[model samples]
Target: MPAITPEQRVLDNLRDTLQAYVAGDVAATAVVTVFRGQAPALALPEAFQRVLDELLRRLEMADVFSQDSCSFSSTGIQEQLGVWLDKAEARVSARTA
Candidate 1:
């Protein structure tokens, strides 16, 4: 396999985080919690962080979009995350398979 670009790495990290959430991995949950707490101070490359941030925002919006009333809720967020993770995992699996 070719080396993963920085942008790809950011996407992969996001995907992995979501996968961990879907799989109910405690470690992943803890990591995410910590990351969220520290996200404001974490010094990441501008381009990489920009893409990741945009992706996250889009995912959050998608969560609200999935609701019948177009409102956001914890349930909507979880559902959206699940759907996004599933699709991402499938894409990764296809690439590797």
Candidate 2:
């Protein structure tokens, strides 16, 4: 088996973190921290990072307010994160190939 690259490792961790958050096994802050902490290692495009930052910001906002009080939708943010992961995985695969 080919060895996994650092970017792939970070992406895997992000996936796990996202899953944990969705399962309510983890907190939003922990998920955000994992994303930010692993971002540099991924070295993804600036555009990707910008979107990620926005999602993280929205996630934090959602976490702050109760569901009834918050306009921000945690479900929407989670869906966006899933899309981001899909694209990131494709990009990394292409880059490493």
RMSD of each: 8.3, 1.2
- Scanning candidate 2 in windows of ten residues, the lowest lDDT window is 66-75
Clashing residue pairs for model 1? none
- Residues 1-97 of candidate 1 have per-residue lDDT tens digits of 8876443464466556666655657343343453344433334446434544454555445444652345445344555555544554455456555
The true-versus-predicted C-alpha distance at residue 62 of model 2, in Å, is 0.3
Per-model CA lDDT versus the true structure: 0.49, 0.90
* Candidate 2 total steric clashes: 0
**lDDT (tens digit, per residue) of candidate 2 on 26-80:** 9999999999998767778999999999999999999999532688899889989
Model 1 regions lying over 4 Å from their true place: 1-3, 27-75, 79-97
Give the poorly placed runs of model 2, Cα more than 4 Å off.
none
In lDDT terms, how accurate is model 1?
0.49
- Model 2 local distance difference test score: 0.90
- TM-score of candidate 2 against the unseen true structure: 0.93
